[model samples]
Target: MPAPRIKICGVTQAATLHACIAARADYVGFNFCPPSPRFLSLPAARDLGAQANGRITRVGLFVDADPATIAEAVEAAGLDAIQLHGSEAPQTVAALKARHGLPVWKVISVSGAADLAPAARYAQAADLVLLDAKTPKGALAGGLGLKFDWTLLAAWRPSGPWGLAGGLNPANVAEAVRVTGAPLVDTASGVETAPGVKDMDLIAAFCQAARS
Candidate 1:
């Protein structure tokens, strides 16, 4: 099988962006949610995105942000795609894709087989679907560093392209691929030394392991 595409999310610094690129990451993500420690200001994200120019895809990550917020980030950050990591509906995904003329990746939190049903709802609107671990009630979306059962995806399929994420580290990435056959894989806290702080060595290891 072809190697799975790797997307390193929650990148907040230029150094981290460079590390991801050096690791040959297929996509580098920037958090736009202000509450996140990995959040980047428009200018900061713009600078880092410029550094990634053409070497890898630049993705802007957002929660349930308003359209204006997304528009500003896209303009300022030069994003190639937008990842909606919130409780957005299918219509919202379609609207964002149409408004920005960019690919939209919708994140679905899954803890059981039933959670997989939502993928079909989003597939009609989103260009890609990201299956991530469900966060605890009343918690923010994503970057929780929690993992769900990979076995739940053993026979899983989606209406569109899809990816696997949440708590995926270098140590288990190969096994993740072996089990789920996910075409893409995304990570954030898994490569971090602390919450929102990415470690270069871990980043490199994850990319290498996933590629191998």
Candidate 2:
């Protein structure tokens, strides 16, 4: 199998973004969730977006945000795509895709085989379905560095494009690919030194390890 594509999420600093580019990460995500420690202000995102304009693919991350909010951010950040980590329905995903004319990724919080059922419904609505760990009650939706049973994905076949996230770090990412056959791998807290602080070395190590 080919090496999985790497996406470094929750990028908050210019240095960190540059590090991802230097490491040849396939995508870079900017968090827009207000509760997230790695949240990016529109102004900051605009600058970062301009900096990364043609050098890399920029994805804006949102959690149940309104259409207007997503629209404004897309313009400010010049995002190539938007990732929704919310309770949005398939119609909502499809509507956003039609409204924005960009790829829309729906995040499915998974704990068991049943959780994978939603992927089929979202296949036509979303450009990609991202399977991530389910957070605790009233907790942050994602980026908590929690992982579910990878074997749960073994028997599951995706209806469309998909990716793996949650608790993936440099140490386990390669094995994650081996088991899940995830064509794309994403990391947020996995490469961080703190809640929102991304370590350059860790980013490099993660990219190398994922492709190793």
Candidate 3:
């Protein structure tokens, strides 16, 4: 099996963005959800996204945001894609993809096998489906550092492209790959020194571990 492509989400600093690039992470995510500690301003996202443009795929993370809001952020940041970490329905995901003409990665918050029931619906509209751990009631969308049972993915079969997220760090990532066969692996809180603070060493270690 191929080593999974890596995404370091919730990147807020230029240095962190550069570190993600230097570490050869495939995707660099910027948060636009207002409630998130990792939230990035459109202007800031613009700058950081530009800094990462050619070397990495810049993904803007949103949570049930309006079309105008997503459009404005895409224009400002020149985002290659947008990740929806909200309660958006299937039609809504399709509408956004049609309006923006950009790939939409819908986050599936999984606590069990039943939670994955929405995958087929979402796959029809979303360009990719990212399976992450379910969060608490009324909590912020992502970077919660919670993990679901990896065995639940033993036969996960999304209609289209898929990836894994939540509670993944260097030490456990190789094993995560071994069990899940996820072609893409995403991490946020796992490499953080604090809420919204990413550690350079952890970022490097995570990329290396995922590839091993």
Candidate 4:
């Protein structure tokens, strides 16, 4: 099998965008969730997306965003796909896909095997199901840098396309892939110096490791 696709997420600067590109990452994510440290305004996201056009697939990360807001960001940023990191229903995913004419990635937060149920629920509507760690109740979603049990995938089989995320870094991404056989892998905080701060060297190391 080919090496897994790598996505360096939550990019907030032109330099970080370039860093991901230089690492030959397949996808680069821009956060649109305002409360996130990595969140970017529509104009900022648009400019960054423009700068990376044609170099890598641009994914806009949203958390429980409304239709109008999603439409606005899609048009403004020219995103290649939308990653829903919220509790959106399968119907919501389908509606967004139909309305935007772009692929949708649904994030499935996993604390146990039961959490994997939604993957099947979203299989038909979502282009990709991103398996992420479940945050503490009442806490913010994703990029918390917490990892779930990778052993959960030992007997798990997804019904459709999927990506693995959560606390993946250069040191352990190889093991993550070995254990999960994921075709696509995403990381944000793992390569950051701090929340929302991308470190180019770590970005490069991570891509190399994921593709190793």
Candidate 5:
């Protein structure tokens, strides 16, 4: 089998970005959600993205942000893709992609088989889909450091590429891939020493484990 694609999200620091690139991560995600501890200012995200060059993909993560905000971040950060981690309607996804001309990744929180139904709607509008663990109501949208049943994704197949996320770490990533057979995986709090602090060693180990 091919190596599993690794996307390290919630990156704020230049060193952490460097760590991810050095680790051969397939994608690096920058949080634009102000509520997230890993959030980055537009200027900071732009600087970090410049550092990435063409070595890895730069993804901008947002939650129910307006078009103006999304446009500003995408221009300022030079993002290659936008990750929508909210209750954005399919129309919103279509508008964002059409207006910005950037690929869109729609994240749907799945807790059960019923949750998978939403992917079909998103797949029609999004360039990719991210199946993540649902955060409880009145909580932060993502990066809550939680995990759901991997079996929930065993039978999931999307029209476009998809990724598995939530509560994935170096220790369990191999098993997570084994169970889901996901071609791509994303990590945020799982690789952090704290809410916003990334552990370089953990990042490297995660990439290695996911590939091995």
Candidate 6:
């Protein structure tokens, strides 16, 4: 099988953003969700996004943010894509795609096989459907280092483009791809030493492992 594409998310600093580019990450995600430790202000995102614009794909991560807020971030950051991590309806995803004229990725919080059902709803609305582990009620949506059963995806096939996230790290990402045959893989907290603290070595290791 071809090596999976890699996305390094929750990047907060210029050095880390440059590390991701040097590491050949396919995409770099900037968190727009206020509650997450990796959240980026508009100014921070713009600076990082400028550095990432041509060298790597820049994706803005949001969680049920109002369209106006999202619009501001997209414009400020020159986002190439928008990734939704909330309970947005298909219409919301479609509308965002129409509004921004960019690829929209919908994250599905998977706990069981039933959770996979939501991907079908986003077939046309989303450019990519990302499967992430489900967090507890009142907790942050993702980037918690929580992992789900990768085997749960063994028998499933998605109609649209898709990727896998949730507790993927340098040590285990190869196994994750082997088990699920994921075409793309994403990581946020997995490459971090602490909450929102990205480790350069970990970032390099993750990229190498995901492609290995």
Q: How high is each candidate's TM-score?
A: 0.98, 0.99, 0.98, 0.98, 0.97, 0.99
Candidate 3 lowest-lDDT run of ten: 153-162
Tens-digit lDDT string for candidate 5 (1-212) = 67789999999999999999999999999999998899899889879988886878999999999999998888888899999999899999999989989999999898899998999997789998999999999888788889899987767777778889989999999999999888899999989989989999999999999998
| Residue range 87-146, candidate 2, lDDT tens digits | 999999989999999999999999989999988999989999999999998999999999
Q: What lDDT is reached at residue 67 by model 4? A: 89
Off by over 4 Å in 5: none
Tens digits of per-residue lDDT, candidate 1, 83-192, equal 99998899999999989999999999998999999899987799999999999988778888888999998777678899999889999998999888989999999999
Model 1 alpha-carbon miss at residue 92, Å:
1.0
What do the candidate models score in CA lDDT, each in turn? 0.92, 0.95, 0.92, 0.93, 0.91, 0.95
lDDT of 3: 0.92
lDDT of 3 by residue, 1-212 (tens): 99899999999999999899999999999899988889999889889878887999989999989889999899888999999999899898888888888899999999999999888888789999999999999898779899899999877776999999999999899999999998999999999989999999999999999999
Off by over 4 Å in 3: none
Model 4: ten consecutive residues of lowest lDDT:
68-77
Kindly list the per-residue Cα lDDT of model 4 for residues 1-212, writing each as its tens digit. Answer: 57999999999999999999999999999899989999989888889989989999999999999888988889888999999999899999999989989999999999998898879999999999999999999887999899999999888989999999999999999889998999999999999989999999999999999988
Residue 46, model 6, lDDT: 86
How many clashes does each candidate structure show, in the order listed? Answer: 0, 0, 0, 0, 0, 0
Query: Regarding lDDT, does 2 or 3 come out ahead?
Result: 2
- Please identify which of the two predictions, 4 or 6, would achieve the higher TM-score against the true structure: 6
Which of 1 and 4 is ahead in TM-score?
4
Candidate 6 segments exceeding 4 Å error = none
Candidate 6 structure quality by residue, lDDT tens digits, 127-201: 999999999999999999999999999889898899999999999999999999899999999999899999999
RMSD of each: 0.9, 0.6, 0.9, 0.7, 0.9, 0.6
